[model samples]
Target: MASIVKRMKLGSQGLDVSAQGLGCMGMSAFYGPPKSEEDMITLIHHAINIGITFLDTSDFYGPHTNEILLGKALKGGMREKVQLATKFGIKRVDGKIEVRGDPAYVRACCEASLKRLDVECIDLYYQHRIDTSVPIEVTMGELKKLVEEGKIKYIGLSEASSATIRRAHAVHPITAIQMEWSLWSRDIEEDIVPTCRELGIGIVPYSPLGRGFFSLGPKVVETYYEHDYRKDLPRFQPENLEHNKYIFERVSEMAARKGCTTSQLALAWVHHQGGDVCPIPGTSKINNLNQNIAALSVKLTPDEMAELESFASAENVKGERSWNKVYSWENSDTPLLSSWKTVE
Candidate 1:
């Protein structure tokens, strides 16, 4: 079957996936209450049929439900059509979030995710958050074993610092680095982006639409549902949002000049970052998914790219990228390899 979405090599490794992946986190968790299972299944199928094959989700999303949902959606011979990616290491226990990367936990999580995803081999598996308690090498050692066991084909790290990425890649060549990278979330560009480029690792930018701010604008905040977590995000707070809205406004103005929707232009910017980049923008609605796919066609020249960058330069943007300090890339480094006994 011909694919509408062009495929690219995600890393120097043999892992190739669609140019743009589908982030399935919102379908079962985070943004709001769980969406209808039937609807999400249909949406996943629609994405695959349209050639958006790289599906991203995590056990942390819906705790466990999202993987189960993907398992269901991949039935009826659909699993073979796309690259499946899921994550582990972040768990909510007793109302507190904990990150673990011990070898025992790594093996358990991988086995559990395999069962939940109902797949023989996961194409890409990422440590959702760096576990500071364990050495990066120790955690990656277990993942390296998974590759040899054929449990996972490729390894990835999320929200990792340049140093941590370097350390983890030494243990096992990291196929990709998943980070929050959008127009407003540009901190990663200074170090993380350069590190990945230097190591020849592919970068998968999550929240490439700035958590929907660039698309829906400040007015969209008023429509948040009761459980909408975005309402509590720093950038979405009334005080910061008042200032941040201007960034969206400027992006909207440029988008209008380009004859595209604000969301399309915002997504296009990520698409244009480079061929090594693939942005996973999540949407529960088919219309939004189609619109995001159209972003691949919204080409940008060097001058326009610089103009867009100026609108959301770090100084002009307000609020922290994440409310939790644990998620900051600066805090993503794990302990030194010598700090822990090497696993045999």
Candidate 2:
């Protein structure tokens, strides 16, 4: 029997989910080679059994295979037990990744995701990335229509600017905003996070474990396979990796003092951030899943929170989160939405 985890509401629209979600991308792609289907299915069942039911996946993951995998696992009455969240808008065309938020694309993606997941409606559907080419209003309007049509239950935006979020929410109620938020990736706190709070939009922090860097230490990057996405990330470069080791050491030392693993300490920090916030950490192993579940109990003191804050400051961390400049649009420090007018 799995333990019961607390639930948190992700938007004023009454979208509530477990305090932590399971990011399913790693099971099908990224990090290294894909895990066996049987193992991935078993892991998801274990997640549901343990009450970690807010499951996250994107259509682009495996380009389409992950949704099929979830569909297979969610069969046999497991579908009703979890809140299924998947993303759209990210596509690989002609060997390059592109974001498409056009209303037509939105509808197509939703329909395809519905078919792939074998679900009547998705619990939460997020626009994976803002297609700067499309007006946020237009995209939100299309999503609004989907809710009315019973294709999706809730709406969300990932890696969108605060202004974009406001614009989208104005068009339709946004249930959640997923972004790269962890002890090391705290830039969203400057504005995006506050904006979510003001709009009653829930904040779901993806890569809350900092893509396994925070949990496995800085040197873990060197162990990534040639095809691993982390290999191209600037922060994982040799020089930058060496520079960022201090962050891992600082958190590890604290975890040791608390008698918890570094990963648990990092997750505890995320859990302590707020009630409306949920962190979805990814893993392909049962042991890591259990360790992450245990983080719900690893509470931190106010002083400890402040200490970790200083240790993980952006100024102390080296290199950009991504090596490709195009991906930087997701960063909170980017220019305001007014500068990047959406296509009319």
Candidate 3:
């Protein structure tokens, strides 16, 4: 039986998707060794069978591998059943990750993603990162062209500042803005959330479980493999992970009182943020997928929401979300449009 999940509207352009989305990054890369393609396909099929219809992937996730995986998974009659979301703009060159938002690059990336996904039009296409080098309007203009040509259904921005979002929205209606918003990552609430609410843009939180910190606890970080992306993140560092244990412990206690798993509690908090907000929690295991989907039913009381909010406030978090200096571009509170040089 497919679980009956509520639908949420993303962006003002009539983009409606399942309230909780499935982030497909881990099935291809990032968390650890890539899961077997057959396993991931089965998992995605199960997700759809259970009513999780919003599937998120990125052309850069596997540097073109993730979309390929999704393409294979959505074969037959599966593609039409879900709202597919994929991102572009981040690419690896000379073994270094680079951001590109040039209008030409935008069109090329979209065409390539369509080829990889084996789909005529992407349901929602997001700029993986704000390319400060190109004026946001230029990138948005290219995306607008894609929409007009029926290459993409709607446009979105990821890790963009409130100012950049406003500028991009002026060019076209941004259906959704993806950000790191979880119980522990509340920085977006300071300005980005308010701006999106005012602009009628939908919010899609990428790491709503704090990169598995909220659900798996600090111990999971200790065992991360050298190749695992989280091994390089500051929050998962030895000292910071120890300090962050307090947060997991507190959340576990609260979950115990609520008679739900810690992950369910964590996801429920994000779900309560607003109807316009959707959280995409990724997992390679089917058990974890079922657990995450169950979160939709773990409704938190107003008092519980307040208490958890106080406990998981940004100040309570002990480490930076990313240790890479390049990631600062995504974390900036203010847009640095003038500081960026165009890619030649």
Candidate 4:
């Protein structure tokens, strides 16, 4: 908690939160492997005690499992210490995605999340993906009503285009926009950032660690598990990883000179971006959580920021940031954070 989180409201009148939030995605799945519930619970409590206030989760992770986990984690007065955010709307079947933002579904999802998280209200609710099957106006309109009913505090969108964002905003002023942001990705800088600023919405950057690629991330996953999803991703392939290490390789060297790990540098880099930008880095280990908390204190000078950017600018990291989906489609910032995503 050494670095004061430059927290701002997700949207004007929205709840205040730590400048950097905690992405709860990795605790249940993704990255290298699945973590035990006991370990994840410990990590969640640790994160809370350390003043990391933003708690992120979604119904999609285990198709209702992650939210349930968080519900159990917040069994006590711990719920009062957090600014919880959970997403709904993206439908999943057999591990494949099916975007569904129907208004009826939105209400149903909200109730389910409430029951899963064991909370009276979700602080900030988001549409996990833009459901083209239903109009954005129709979906957001229902969300506005939820706000009125006090079922949710604020609304946010993920992986949505500028047009969709604007349409949603017209229905209700968005509190924050959650998506992937890191030193490697820049797609939102040009449009999304500007729009959020103009509308007074906050930006919550998920995977600020580049899916743990910035430092100390394993080279690969041998076998896919029921909860593990990274094995199917392109970046995990041996061929891509072999070439992609170049992006973070330099980061490791920089960390050596700075007397920190590549992970520290990555988190520091996220903090240096802007007061409005909050990077949520997820980890299920107490040691890593401690290290992540320490990142709030890792300072980078303007020159250092430029240097890091300069070094990352040249390399083309292999693999795609997202699989074949509209949200995973090409964007500008992908090259910087997702440099290794397309190397192969």
Candidate 5:
């Protein structure tokens, strides 16, 4: 019941959160079927007990289940102890996935999340995916109003391009930009990472453990349940999996030399990125959470960082960071505000 994690500023704009966050997506959906609500609540409480309080979730995660679960978990004064974050803009309609970022949808989603989360204000709210058709300014305009109204504390964007980030930040200061940045996922480094650093926005790296690949290694693919969504990702396919296993092997060898587990080393690499960067690594079990938290202690020298990078350099890693091309940062730019017209 003692604090094990440190608190750090996520962005220059006065938003502070735990050094690392607990990603709550897997507890309700994506990785597999829904876990027992009772057990997940216990896991959530345990995370807070150990100081991993920057909890992240999205409305589309279960299409709603995840937020409701967090609402329940944060009851009995638990909500007062954490910096809760949830996202919107990704939805499913008639079995198809869609992303929305218009002012109307933004306001509606914020209201709905406030209700679901049972909180007066959200610590941070993000557009889960960019809506290419809507102008970033328009979406952020509404979010700015929310900030004025005290509906949300700060704005954030996930999987957004450098241009979109600038436009969104011009409308309202972006506290964080959540993206997939891990040993195997380094495409953001070319532009997005630098843009955020220049603009003083924090980087929240989701899937910091390579979606569980670094933790369990290649054979872990065999343990995927029938409904596990990871099975659909190309990197885990038999062909790509064969090629990717070596990256894990090399990382494992380095981890052994570093006196830590492969998962810890992989996460530590992200932690070493800088104090402005925070990685939200998700797990369904307490032991895994402990291992991830321990990653904060696995320091690496510059050579070790570069050597780890060599193992899973983008070219060496197979498959796209996203299964759907549209969901990635490359395709996340929105129309200019000057070119946007509202449909009545």
Candidate 6:
């Protein structure tokens, strides 16, 4: 055997995963257009063949359509090829987004996910977001119960603050922390990264390409479907798009100098964060998926990493990632001390 399974342990619970994981969100809807069922199936099979096994998904995406698509992909022998990870907690109910960490919701969500994924047990189950009103202990306590019952192999959290992470860790060992991290989105590096490294929690980054802003094409930007959320994102605005184009052109130039695609340069830079960091870039097209996975081979030297950092710091990239009133993506708008209360 030529050493196939890419293993990077997430935490104290001994939960190891592939060096690169496949994020299945785009196949359901969020990217731009709805991808065909056949493309999703072929993409899953191709991922297995390339030795990329860690798969990340959530129940809220497509309001359950993505899990159904993944279930279809896992049929027969292909199910054995992945170390599965899925989340529940943040949900959209009656057109209103809510975070439900209630124990009742947890059990119901797991059952629904099981039915959709067609899997007996999920390898890694995460609390997509903490319902601050519910208390971290209460939520993790319920998740702990699931672990004992064999519904999940390990526990993880997403977009949680450092204090929340500490409180949750005290309740039970957190295997990994999934958040948005890239050269463009380095906010997590300040506190979250240090906390995860100190606690041995693996960091899985989503949106490693700055929402395709690196080769960052104009044609690609205009192709967004009506339902696509990126159209509202600050980065995609006409004014910011023009300003950001220069930054991406620089990124493309750097990629050409290093002999790789702009996407590859972005992903490779994310991988450089540390050995414990793994990025799951989602794409519905097989060509994009292939280009993304090939990023693993594009390693940057120490000097190159420094150059990348300096290049990014110098850019006057316009617009925050989110609309001003709503708040920035992968970052907090409310102050750290303020408490979160549920609408219900």
**How do the candidates rank by lDDT, highest first?**
5, 1, 2, 3, 6, 4
User: What is the TM-score of each predicted model, taking all chains together?
Assistant: 0.97, 0.95, 0.95, 0.89, 0.98, 0.91
Error of 3 at 43 (Å): 0.4
Which window of 10 residues has the lowest lDDT sum in candidate 6?
325-334
Model 1: per-residue Cα lDDT over 1-344, one tens digit each: 45679899998998989999999999999888899999999999999998999999999998899999999999999999989999988998899988999999999999999999999999999999999879899899999999999999999999899999999998889999999999998888888898999999999999999888987889879768888888778888899999999998999899989999999998999999998999999999999999999999999999999999999998998888788877667798776776566542
lDDT of 3: 0.88
**Native-vs-model 2 lDDT?**
0.88
TM-score: the better of candidates 5 and 6? 5
Candidate with better lDDT, 2 vs 5: 5
Clashes of each: 0, 0, 1, 17, 0, 0
Model 3 compared with the native: what TM-score?
A: 0.95
Tens-digit lDDT track of model 5 for 1-344: 78999999998898889999999999989887899999999999999999999999999988799999999999999998999999999999898999998889999999999999999999999999999988888899999999999999988999999999998988889999999999999889989999999999999999999899999888888768878888889999889999999999999999999999999999999999999999999988999999999999998999999999999998899887668989888898887667666442
For candidate 6, give the lDDT of residue 16: 69
Worst 10 residues of 2 by lDDT: 328-337
Q: lDDT of each prediction vs. the true structure?
A: 0.92, 0.88, 0.88, 0.77, 0.93, 0.79
Candidate 5 lDDT score relative to the true structure: 0.93
- Over all chains combined, what TM-score does candidate 5 have? 0.98
**Candidate 2 — which residues are off by over 4 angstroms?**
328-344
lDDT score, candidate 1: 0.92
The worst-scoring run of ten residues by lDDT in candidate 4 lies at 329-338
The best candidate in terms of TM-score: 5
lDDT of 3 by residue, 1-344 (tens): 75677787787889889889999998888877778999999999999988899999999887789999999999999999899999998888998888888889999999999999999999999998877567888788899999999999999998888888888899899999999888888878888999999999999998899888887897786657668888878888888888888889999999999898998999999999999999999999899998998999898889999999888777777888877645443443333345544333
